[model samples]
Target: MIEKIGNAIKDKNKSAVLLLLACFIFVFILPAIEFTSNMLSIFLFSLIIFLASYPISRKVMFIGFVVILIELATRATDFIYVQYLAQLTTNLFIIFLVGSVIRHMMNQKNISIYTLVKALNGYLLLGIMFMSLVAFCDLYMPGSFNSSGNSDMELVYYTLITLTTAGYGDITPQLPLAQSLAMLIAVTGQFYVAVVVAILVGKYASKN
Candidate 1:
């Protein structure tokens, strides 16, 4: 069973589908279950390791798994430093995975549904990466956002909103760092869209 699962994740298209499912659960479903709320960071980190297994090196995968185990073991202690490390690690892992996805998309000779799915996965991963950053800022620096008692879901919503450049203004960033992150998220989102579109169009044009 384990080997089967590993093989499924080894395929780019299959792994993209799995990542999308995990992202949907993290964003939409997990928040509804009250007990799972605090596990958000760990869940995201686990996904990082799982998705990284195929594209990244074995050494990186082992390191990520070790970090996840450490985070789980120390969950009861709630050490501020440990939490910071976990969040930072999660952000870095997602960033690397996103880069891998982009490189894979660019290297594809033909555009197809799999290519489109990979592009979508990359976009969602960007939002997830920024969400981790937002959470890190809020965790270490209280009052980073104007809203009080911000839930994980609320943070996810705020990140997506900022990523999409919707600017609803419901949950505005308070601190300078948070404000800067918001701008970075919006710009990164637009840049990803432009790059993906260009790659797809170029592939299509070349095929003609």
Candidate 2:
């Protein structure tokens, strides 16, 4: 079954379309299964992105990336409050993806120190923008992610502020899960900037 499905996706036949639709339904229709199914959706999404990038080149990956995000948001939306938030974040993500993808694609040059630094900066910017979207959805849009028994808004607020290193007092995460995620995002954000900047600076020095 897995092989067959993989082949279908590879072929881009009717089954692939059906599977994509099924993925959409599973991702959005079963909010009860959001965590479980989203795991699957996310896995497939990663492949879709890699395929999208490899086949069309990274230059075209942004469109697929943005489409996937919007599709997920559309499917997940149900409650009015959550739907509103989903709509907002989805739009922002699409815009960010377009700008990020275009800049990277347009600037592509033979891989070297200069290209490497720019690519890292590009990826880091993309990652943070994506994280921001997730934070927004997690906070404002209920059911976009499972709360596991906590205030969703608090999660959103904490995610955004923490990722930005804002450390706002109003939305400190008390739960172990939230705290862990907060720590992870903080590390990710800082490391991304540090590593990318260092690489670019190194490249600059070598060029001079």
Candidate 3:
């Protein structure tokens, strides 16, 4: 079983699949259930982070995991400045890790189903990273975002809507820095879809 887990970690596709599964559960399923204890959410998020980190660097992964533990340790405090700081730092690392994964996927000599999955994974991870940035900004400057910094689900929704350029206008950024970051997220999403996604689709079709 240990060897099998190691093999899965070494395979980008397997890691991507696991990440997607964890994300789907956390993003879609967990929100609907009314649970007073946050144990379920914590478990799902940790699982997602572990699986996503597996495909990147082990050292980076270890650091992220440590940051997560510290974040959890500080959760009970009345003042959570340190918790937000740790979250921001860990999320920045995650952004780099996901970018590395995307770079590796694009540098592949041949496209396959794994490549396609990795591409999708990159898209999802990119949105999540931007969401983390937005959350961090909100924590840094209270009322920077239209929504209260209370629910992860709301942040995920805002991130997806912003990435897709839907701009429902429900969660506008209040501060200048937040506005700039929002615009950057929108542009990055467009560029990714127009360039990277287009190239990947073309290559996949050519392979078939």
Candidate 4:
């Protein structure tokens, strides 16, 4: 059973599907439920890491597992130091995952549904990764963002809007670090879209 599961995860398209589904739930569904402990959020994050990391390497998968363990400890203890560790590990893992997805897409010779899904997954992961950074900034410096509360879901929402360059003005970044992060997120979002479209078009043209 373990081998079968590993083999299934090794399939890039299958893995991308699972990762995208997990991201969709974390981004869309979990916020509505709004659990106080954010237990569900972390669980989905761990699942995404597990799915996303397998396509890269077993080493990355193991590291992501360790990060998930740290996140679980953060939720259980709610210690500031553990939270810091969780934030760091989660941020690094997501960054690595995003890079791996982009690298994989770049190496693909044909543009298919898997390529499109990987692109989408990478985009969503970019948003979530920035969300982690935003949360880290808030944790390190309280009142970083002008939100009613510092919930993970609120950060996710703010990050998504900032990433899309929406500038809703409802949740503004107050601190220097937070404001810089918002700008970086917005720029990175635009850059990712531009690069991915170029890659896809190039691949399609080559195929034709």
Candidate 5:
């Protein structure tokens, strides 16, 4: 699938570039739009899982989407509490897609992984950056902004702190919106760390 996309780009297929760009732009739109937490959760999650798995395997991706929907209905609505995580995940998927394309392009240009890793790393780091950005954008998000922690910057810093699980309690949420965000960060952060680290460790062990 990636190879075919690469060929299309190399051939300067205008339609193909536009299609990819459209998908790429969807990432930014989800964050910028003011969606209620409930609405955002369903829409964004479905969109992201669809985008990620669609290229590699449509059937498997469909199954993944169903599983996520079920999870949302049955268990975890915390996802909606901090829709920023959803936005960040969407942006991260876009970053990964863009990186994959750039890697393919560079591969054509015969660049080394030694050089490619730098770009890959930069895109991955954008995940962290986007998390911070989403927290800021929520200030403008349609939901009620509970003016907690004095300023937006303070809230962002605290969001990062909660996300990293560094709960020193210098700042805390006094409002429902802020508390929900904190809860989202705490749970989401743990899940993210556990899954990502487990995958990396599993890969290393298998490689050994």
Candidate 6:
């Protein structure tokens, strides 16, 4: 079984596999589990940092490590501004890193299972990153959003909904900043799908 798993990973792109794992943890596991602890958050952050760093440059990886440490350190602090700074910087770095990975995948000019996986990972990561941004806005301005729950999982769900332009209307952003961010998230989702899907589909078509 171990050998089989190894072969499967080898068959696909390593980065894609890692990204998928991170996505699974964020989308499925985190939401399913109750009473998420700080330890769990740290573990999840570590896993994601590991997953995301492999495909990036050493310098980028170093910066990511630093940001993660900052987040871990300040996450428990009472200072809201400090928390926001860490979270925002970490999310921004991740967004840039994932975008870089997507660009790298596109440059390869061959569409494979891993390429598609990476594309999906990029999309999911966008939702996660923006969710953090919205959460940050919430930190400074409470009730920036109206939701059934204010947990991280709920925020993630809302982020996905906004990204897909579903607009279920259950969760509404109240603050102007939240509203603008939501709009930007929707537009970004549309643009990413249109542009990235076109490139990948065109490449696949040309290859065949």
Best by lDDT: 4
Q: Pick the candidate with the highest TM-score.
A: 4
Q: Per-prediction RMSD in angstroms?
A: 2.8, 14.2, 2.7, 2.7, 11.4, 2.7
Tens-digit lDDT track of model 3 for 16-122: 78777777776666655645678887787677777777666688678778877887777777777777776777787778777887787788878888777777778
9-106 per-residue lDDT for model 6 (tens digits) = 44438756866887778766777675556677667766666566666666876888888899888978999788878887887887787687677767
Candidate 1 C-alpha lDDT tens digits along 18-49: 87778777666676564444566566658755
Candidate 6 runs further than 4 Å off: 1-12, 76-80, 148-150
Backbone clash pairs for candidate 2 read none
Off by over 4 Å in 1: 1-7, 32-45, 74-79, 204-208
Identify the superior model by TM-score, candidate 2 or candidate 4. Answer: 4
For lDDT, candidate 1 versus 6, the one ahead is 6
lDDT of each: 0.75, 0.50, 0.79, 0.82, 0.48, 0.77
Q: Give the TM-score of candidate 2.
A: 0.39
Worst 10 residues of 6 by lDDT: 6-15
Lowest lDDT 10-mer window, candidate 1?
32-41
Range of the 10 consecutive residues with the lowest summed lDDT in candidate 3: 26-35
Model 3 local distance difference test score: 0.79
Better of 1 and 6 by TM-score: 6
Q: How do the candidates rank by TM-score, highest first?
A: 4, 6, 3, 1, 2, 5
